[model samples]
Target: MGELDTFTDALDYPVYVVTTAAGERMAGCLVGFASQCSMDPPRFMVWLSKANRTYRVARDASHLAVHTLRDDQRDTAELFGGRTGDEIDKFEHIGWRWPTAAGAATAPVLDDVSAWFLGRVEGRVDGGDHVGFLLSPVAESPAGPVRPPLLLLSDVVDLSPGHPA
Candidate 1:
């Protein structure tokens, strides 16, 4: 372990809930390592920890849904971040609707999301402990009436990972 640092060190980045659909179900989790990696072609990248069950499922996924939480939706963050999908379906507790897209699987798009993007995996890179998935946004939507402030890392400090940390 390294020297102790302030909690703020870990609370710097914006968090997102990433979802993937495989067969008849969907899996999602709170993701801290994700960003727009390209501009001209418009690419986004998300790193998924190998230990997460969501990662295992996402490995086989063709499309991924990235959703930002509204500041009031801390519970949504807790549900996806703190609990493992191996035990329960997180979508069961959240209100969401499936959007239709050709050549891609469907994942639930939460009703209260601040914003969302559906991406097709273009490439993947192995980064030791985590895998980086490069995505091309095929579709996007902004929450119009529900344009609430986004939930950040600080708001989810108490949530424990469903998998081993």
Candidate 2:
């Protein structure tokens, strides 16, 4: 409706599925707003919608797993972006695991992805309607010889948000 909105609407970035765990509770959401913010310490930031279920669970989570959706993972995108976790148990339907490191169990990690990383939450930044979770990548999944193209926001723009943002 405004110039700022128009500028943002023209932007397209890779989509990500961010998952977090708090005790036995787990939550994940499709995220379009994220980027590598720093190079020195290798920091990645993910903005979680305040209204999304994942934001609530991630509030107290120590770590999070970021899954980069592949070009063919539209179904996976739909499941996370279109369904509300407040009404359903998405994990029960998705194939995920708590990627272990030094036998230290962590959050739910999506099984199939172009790439995923486990990160320790270093800080949080409030961004009006959303919150940015600053991450320090601890472990990354094995990279494939042929890296698949990442799924972009335009690929899932038709999807309505599971929770109002």
Q: Write the per-residue lDDT of candidate 1 for residues 88-134, one digit (tens) a residue.
A: 98888988877565344456677768898888889999987889989
Candidate 2, residue 7: Cα displacement in angstroms equals 1.4
Q: Cα lDDT for residue 95, model 1?
A: 84
Full-model lDDT, candidate 1: 0.83
What is the per-residue lDDT of model 2 for residues 1-165, given as tens digits with 9 covering 90 to 100?
Answer: 765997899899899999999887899999988999999999999999999999999998998899998999999999999998999998888788878761476678888888999989999999989999999998889879997888999999999889998
Q: Which ten residues in a row have the lowest lDDT in candidate 2?
A: 98-107
Best by TM-score: 2
Q: How high a TM-score does candidate 2 get? A: 0.96
Q: Give, for candidate 1, the lowest lDDT window spanning 10 residues.
A: 99-108
Error of 1 at 143 (Å): 5.7
